[model samples]
Target: MRNKIFQKLKQGYSHLGLGDDILQAHAEGLVATGLVTDENIDNVVNTQKSFLESLQKANDARATSAATRAKEAARKEFEDAAKAAADEKARKEKEEREHKEKEKEMPDWYKTEKAASDKTIRELLDSIKTMKEGYDTMKDENDRFKVEKAVTERKNLIISKAKELGIPQYRIDEGFAIADDADEAKIGEYLTKVANNTKAQVLPGNRDMFPLADKQPSVENIKSIVDKLCPK
Candidate 1:
């Protein structure tokens, strides 16, 4: 069947080259080696179409594979990114919890140091107040003692200071008598007054220091002794 189609195709081409023969005899048998023929052209067209269809099918499969691989990679990347985000959030939350716990912690030193500092300040203030009270009390006692000594005895120190200033001891005694109130607590007032009035520096036995008697002197008696000793 292929030979019959080849013979017909060759005869058709030979007839195309006839010049003046209205119906000349065609040398169509030579079509078997002719370069131009319908059957061979159609076969080449079919073969090229088949080859193009194969190449297109192969390209379609390669495109599908590339798309599938791209999709799988994209899916894996998205999953990894989600896990990283979750891990980061969890880490931040854990750190915040730890920070809160640290904030709540307290040690013994923190409590005791503050307590000791407060106590020391309080003690120092109390000690300062006590020392001020003691100093004020001592000042009052010392002033009272001075008044009592001047009233109760001839201050040998005063007499000595008076003699250095060329003042007589009698004048010193008279000055002291003027200042003395002769309170009963001062036991030596009367005897000192008597000794000053008599100008007798020495007296007998234990009475030389003007000892207290069993009874306190009356105000009038004390006043009378003072008037005689000073006269003013």
Candidate 2:
């Protein structure tokens, strides 16, 4: 009967997947307690089998709970990682878009400086052009003034020399009209010829017509004659 109980306990514990060492320890403990008997042997086997089944069920429940906890943790980790990656991607895309926008537009400071520089260049060019025009105009006026001064001096010299030669005003006027472009030497020669012609035109016994032909004229007589002939 003891052997039959031992066999039954071994078969039952083995079916419950208990290790050899645990089954041996439990069987030895039951024998030391004097619980195995012909009358209670089947009851002891059934009771031990029932206790082992309840323990296995509790272990399975804990293992199932632990597996569920681990699966939930893994899913949360995956979701958190996915969210972080999406946020990083969005941040990089936003930065790239801002960079592209910056590339399309120039800075305000640079645009303002360039515009000011262009304006200054135009003003400088205009100033230079205006100065050049003013210089040219002044040069032309100066040249015209010099020419007019030279012509006036030449006319004054011719008139003075003609008066000194005692040439008549009418003859001097005719000479001035004909010798408009004559130099000092030509004017002097022309006045000398007119004086000689006046001396040669002295009429015989016409003393009044040739008074100055025989004698050198006084400065006052020449002035009086010139004033009467040429007036103011």
Candidate 3:
């Protein structure tokens, strides 16, 4: 079958310059047997093959360009996201640093309270040293010596109690100066009054550095404080 078709195709080509009837017979034979028939069959096949190859090359180039564009776009997006994250981190760090700076700037109430506490601690230390010195020197039996010793001991007891109870030095000093003749129990009671009055004046949400109840000091409490101070 294939040989017949080839023979017809060759006959068609061979009769290209022959008489029209003979060429037509070969052409008709080729067409009937399903062989080559188009006048420009070779040129058209070559042209079509070249055209398809060019089309495939063009499509491949386009695909490569699209991939390059996608890669560039993804890189730019990642860079933008990274930059935004860094900026956000810097913003939060700045906020935290500013907040810490604000905290370092102490408020007026804190400053005042700190100063008072410092003064209280200082005065208490000094009074303790002076009282210990006086106590070491009280050896004479004279009335003057006895009175001086009694006064020093009493003041020492008051100072020690105030220091132990976290009472401010100012209140202790003021109470002693005005009511030095008061008994130890009465002195404690008076100090308690001063502490309560001071607490009443304190602003809401502010804690008192030296807090004391309004209740009067009991004899037992006074005795305990005295024993601790003078120690048998």
Candidate 4:
């Protein structure tokens, strides 16, 4: 229908020397002579308005499609960024574990130094233990309060020395808890045994400083502490 209107306009304006100007002198001459009616000019105006409306609708559709495409692209980019961040975190954790494993493979010099340090610590502990034993033997002779005070001081000294030898504070505390009823000599031996290993070092051969004769788990020992669980 729109095409038909354009054809009509062309035929009517042909006599005006191809000029579609609304007020062409030739067109005006035709209109005054009644060759072309006012209806023909009105038709031309209505045709242009219809064409402009069609073009605007096409432009609006294109803009909507472009907005949709832009939104989808942004969503895809966000997903990719999230995946990349998770992968980077996993890579860092793996690298840290590998680094720690390498560190655990100590050099020969470090082992020798550690062994000598252990020997020195053990000797100091043995001397301290001997002194404590002498104090214990005089338990009846010495004032009770004086003996308890001396034992507390010796225990503190042992804890400080153990920390200096690189034992973790928690392990020292655990040792004290496990050896609360043990004599000062036994406490020295237990700490000395643990002094060679890294922080939070568990006793390799035995978990208990005072194992029961029945070989049963008491309220103090939890199996999970000594055993590593398989992942589900």
Candidate 5:
């Protein structure tokens, strides 16, 4: 539309031999002949200016709307991509968890019994090592009864050591055994872990207060302690 209007204006201008004076004289001639008036020329100029302003405003609004629409489309595409990525991650994690659960649920003779025995072996090993170390450290006393006191003292020392190692739960009393049907290897590994956890250092003379056996002294013999304190 602008191109067409500009072409028309050029045509009119060229007809006047590109001379501003000729254009002005021609316009005045029309007014003198009563064909046009000054008020009519002024009104036409003002109307043309207002129409051009409105056209420019409409063009600006159209450009802004196109830009906004493009941004919205791009944002939606990115959002879809992110959602798909999250869904894939969640699915993989769920599949892995389900596979692990299936593995755990499948039980067998070797798995169950061996695991239990292993547990028993671990506890026994740690307890025996602790008992032996504590027994060797005690000073000799004249009375045979003092042997009993010394053994009990040793067990208490081991308990304290276990507690210090951050494994108070793993600390074995005089008598603790895995279930009869426990897996030997698993039980052994557990006992080893317990022993490792219980292998802790302590300050001197505090062993007496934290006795391994409370109701009965851990002295003289483990069999006696087990029978009296923890028959199981």
Candidate 6:
């Protein structure tokens, strides 16, 4: 029975990575001290194996707990990273949306200015069309008189424009007679060409520059001559 207990203890200690030689030496010392006997040898072996098993169970539980903690930490890190990426994407999208919205909006001043410009153009076009229609529908003597009056008004406007451009009255009348069938735009073009041609012939200074020998120069005329000689 003692041999059987020793063999069982050796097997249990060996399975727990304790060498047989060490176990044998320990058992011998216990026996020499009279600590182990045939009556208690089996109980001693059982107690030692139970202690070793408990130690192994404790080590395994510690390993499992460490693995669980590491996994939780990794999962939390991944979730945080994913949340940060999502937040960045949302922020960029919001900025882009606001930028597009800003681009789509026009200023009140620009809108008002454009509306006014469009209205003015429409009114001008309508006025021109109405004038053309009235001219085309002439029938009676009164309608002919209205047509003549309109023609006279247009001629007067052309004469005024030509005078503004420094064109002589006789030249303006001659040009009108030559382009009597032409529209106002054509007449304007002719006047512009004439004005450009006559620019080189225009002399500098006023009539005071060529005063008659009999006429004495006034103070204003003398000041004008001094201004030309030594301009401010």
Give me the candidate number with maximum TM-score: 2
Off by over 4 Å in 6: 1-10, 13-43, 107-232
Local accuracy of candidate 3 as per-residue lDDT tens digits, 84-195: 9999999999999997787679898887898799999999999999997787666444567879989889878878766656565555667644376788788778666665
Roughly what TM-score does model 3 have, to 2 decimal places? 0.30
User: Over the stretch 33-122, how does candidate 1's per-residue lDDT look in tens digits?
Assistant: 374355565453233344434545676788899999999999999999999999999999999999778655857787678679999999
lDDT tens string, model 5, 123-147?
9999999998777665333356687
- Give, for candidate 5, the lowest lDDT window spanning 10 residues: 197-206
TM-score: model 1 vs. ground truth: 0.29
Clashing pairs in 2: none
Over 49-117, each residue of candidate 6 has an lDDT whose tens digit, in order, gives: 676566557767888999999999999999999999999999999999997787569788877887799
**What's model 6's lDDT at 163?**
80
How many collisions per candidate? 0, 0, 0, 0, 23, 0
- Specify the highest-lDDT model's number: 2
Give TM-scores for every candidate, taking all chains together and pairing residue i with residue i: 0.29, 0.41, 0.30, 0.28, 0.30, 0.33
- The Cα local distance difference test for each model comes to 0.55, 0.76, 0.62, 0.61, 0.55, 0.70
Model 5 misplacement above 4 A: 1-46, 108-232
TM-score of 2: 0.41
Ranking by lDDT: 2, 6, 3, 4, 1, 5
Q: What is the alpha-carbon lDDT of model 1 when measured against the actual structure?
A: 0.55
List candidate 3 segments past 4 Å from native: 1-39, 108-232
- Candidate 3 clashes: the total is 0
- Give the candidates in order of TM-score, highest first: 2, 6, 5, 3, 1, 4
Model 2 C-alpha lDDT per residue in residues 1-232, reported as the tens digit of each score: 4457567777767766666666666677778888688888878878886777776678678889999999999999999999999999999999999977875687889778877999999999999999999999999999999999998898789889978887667766775553677777888887788777764454233357435645766566566555644555
